[model samples]
Target: MSKNVPGIMRQKPITPWLYLVPSLIVMFTFIVYPGVNTFYLSLRNADNTAWASTACKAGESCWGIFENYHYAITSEIMQTAFLNNIKWILIMVTGTVALGLLIAVLADRVRYESVAKSLIFLPMAISFVGAGVIWKFMYNYESGTNQIGLLNAIITALGGQPVSWLTEPQINTIALIVVGIWMWTGFCMTILAAGLRGVPEEILEAARVDGANEWMVFWKIMIPQILPTITVVITTMVINVLKIFDIVYVMTGGNYGTEVIANRLYTEMYKSYQPGRASAIAVVLILVIIPAMIMNIRRFNEQEATR
Candidate 1:
């Protein structure tokens, strides 16, 4: 038996497959099956009892096999939700990365750097639901009563009228995006801070020695060095913003024009009982996320190769 080592090596490669069995089983069971089922359900009617072809009733024009997908694309609510997700990607990602980078650079030069970073990152420890509820109160409005919400209280104290943070359609989505930015800025700061720490001090000193002011050194030297890290952060934020759900659900239940893709999926699935529509939304969301995910993977591979 001890002398069978060479013989064992010559045998079929079943050992690796055996090791992979459990993982493959788990992946198929949890990820693969659900994804396939979702796509399958997307082609059917609301409860999957009928083909999407029957979605047309008599005089109604039929969209054939992809009625749900059509609805996902053309429906007003879905269009609004899609646009909101795009808005989230634009504003929240920009604000998060910009503020994070600025704070990271400033914090690095400060005396209590650790404390400063810790305070900024504290919001990340809170669950999104919790953060939403906290901000909900912070944005609360009571017209007749004395303001209890912090923002309104401050505004009223300064002789300004209370602002409707959540109800107004014009600014509600922006309000939600603000909460997202606040919660995620700390995460961006921590990652960018690590990137900043990796910069070669000699290059920075040399640039300054060549008469580059701090601003010029930052933009010309530090930024280019950390551009990869910034790209990763931006893509990560994009993906996060695309699938934003918990906070929107907790705070507004996707009301007042704050709808996003994931929130719309939840609404269709649970509230409206439109499983087909929900599945269509899910598929669309996956498609949207794929590009960002691919970029992130490429960036990771490049980093690994350079190392």
Candidate 2:
């Protein structure tokens, strides 16, 4: 054997795993255990009354294996929540990405880039629940000179009627979405701005030398170069959107036509005490996220390989 082989043999074989032992223990104790329990609970009835009290052959109506799924699919509020999630995904993703990219490009060369970015990214420091409470006060709607919400106050000052920003099915969903955009836009901006910086100055100057206009160069060169980062940001936002609960919970409590999937899961599990249905909803949500997560992982791996 080579001299190096003897030296390697002298080293502790479990050294690498020694470092991993703590992490592995933590994962098993927390993440893996909880995940397994959630799945196990999902298979049982709400309160586990279906299987625990009797045999698995409990009557069709008495013990339904797929009954939770059926209830989740058919429930009116559940349906509304799912549809609202779709809306949330569409509108929030579009607004966050569009605004983030716009601000990133505009601030890329500004003298006050740091200050501008700091102001925008400041919201990222606040918790989602904290931002919700801040905006809830902003959307408050007490009448007369006592108007508490900034928005209602502004409208009143402008001689317009004070509108309820967080009520009314027609507008409440939109109201909640606005808060979400406010909280997340900064995060998207930071990621996208970093991506923009990665695009070499030399390439941009070369593109200009070839007579490409500002818009053309942006569309043809800068955007293409930054596309990977954009994809990662989008996939991340999609995952966030899929699991969005805090804003809806704080602002509306999933009431007045503003329920989303995660909120529904919370309501089912905690409020309604319907474990089976809640687990079903959780499973459905996991299914929806699987594809987006797979894409994100692939992109991440590709980036790692390139680096």
Candidate 3:
């Protein structure tokens, strides 16, 4: 009876993976499987016919690694798309974050702070595609009649020639950047305002007692204290700029030299019917965004650990 009791007392060892089964299954099905399939498809020829035939014959299709990648890099459209992406990142990220911070600071102490912020934040409520369409109408060009485009209308009213807003390659990029800034500035302001609220009033009062002017206090005191929030805002803006697709797609459709990485990917896959090339573009986009995301994660973790 003692031997039977001892045998029954022994319990089964716990399997660590038992707790992770659901998450593991979800990741495997959603992320891992799709990523592997995309990478495999990216190695095949443009039309996907060769890959389909090879798979039918031998249960697998494998073009040499980097062949599609090489083609994508060498292609003229892809090159232009890459350059446009760089331009978007530079202009959109800087403009939105800087302008948003300025506006946030100014509005914080204003008489009608809520009204000012609400008006600015209105654009953010609109979908990117919808905003693009609205801007497109506002930029419409006519040959003979007075321009209806808001910018051109003002120019014509001032006795200046009406310039094409979306047609001119150099100006078109800037125009698109303006739309992005309009849409995202509110997001930056909201985040920065919250950060501003977190600043201790006693510290600000101490600065005042030390005879620091408003400008000095802002630059030395407020800016340093809110640096973490600024980092997060800039990082978020960078990721958004990298993934920008809908506005450019709706406005220019990668035409008039306004091509971007995501737009180029869409054209390659759907318009040009080149799955391999599209997959290569997708992979490159993933590579570009991964570092930014990793840095943001690290910064967030560090902030949390410090807290």
Candidate 4:
């Protein structure tokens, strides 16, 4: 930005760019270079000795460059992982945001708002891995006297069978989603509470005076007023959902059909020792996230404009 001086605007020169040199250097070194290289590697065969081929015949190398992308798209495990990632986004984002908004609204009317909020938001203080570990113990399903998991213990006490919570594909996915929701709900509550606090008290009074019921006011007025905040929260949560790794990694290690994109990339790169496939997966993930990042940036700009 330039200021008008004596009816003339003067543009800054190389000095401004000079000031950006250090940060730009770091960005290019850490982000830009790696990103470019990842794309390059993604185009190479799984072994990276040559360009990838699309052939998938007998006695032929199926680890061609495009083969990784094809495998990612066609493999049963990859499909499961992709679908589970979608499930994660839907459950974690909606559940966390909805629960957070509910808590935020309730806290606003409570005398012990700070205490209630502190307790609810306390989970946000725990690391994702720690939260997963805690929940793992909670879902333990040891046999007989060795049963120590809280869930199994409670079930058994209620005269029910002790079920394996994390090892079963059908149940494990949902179980991991629950842990994600728990870890992130507090973050949503804190942000939305701030957004709610920013609402004008006078507007709320006006709505009340107009005979708007609490539910009506919440849905029609308060929510609309904080819509921008919700948009930001949703977009942030979506991004988080896409990169979700720690909780799933800690609790299931992508086992029993609980894999997500990041976890797959991890296994492909390290566990399976397939850099080309890993880079391809990375590229696939980056492509998926670009649109979301763009939308978030646009919303951010819109928010700033309003403020």
Who wins the lDDT comparison?
A: 1
Poorest 10 consecutive residues by lDDT, candidate 3: 52-61
Ranking by TM-score: 1, 4, 2, 3
Give me the runs in candidate 1 sitting further than 4 Å from their true place: 1-5, 8-11, 58-61
Q: lDDT tens string, model 2, 185-242? A: 9999999999999999999999999999999988999899999899999999999999
Worst 10 residues of 2 by lDDT: 51-60
> How far out, in Å, is residue 201 in model 2?
1.0
Count of clashing residue pairs in every prediction = 0, 0, 0, 1
| Evaluation by TM-score, superior candidate among 3 and 4 | 4
lDDT comparison, 2 vs 3, better candidate? 2
Model 2 score (lDDT): 0.87
Highest-scoring model, TM-score: 1
CA lDDT of each candidate? Answer: 0.92, 0.87, 0.84, 0.87
Write candidate 3's Cα lDDT for 1-307 as tens digits: 5557776675456556777799999999999998888888877777665542332224443344566776567768888888888898898889888888888889988999999999988999999999999999888777654787887787788888888888799799889989999999999999988888888999999999999998998899999999988988888888899889999999988789999888888888998887987898888888889988988888788778978
lDDT of 4 by residue, 96-199 (tens): 99999999999988999999999988888999989989999999888784579998888888888898999987789889989888888889999999999999
Q: What tens-digit string does per-residue lDDT give for candidate 1 at 1-307?
A: 7476787466565878988999999999999999999999999998688988778678765689899998888899999999999899989999999999999999988999999999999999999999999999999998944998999999999999999999999988898889998999999999999999999999999998999999999999899999989999999999999999998999899998889999999999999999999999999999999999999999988878977
Residue 112 CA error for candidate 4 (Å)?
1.6
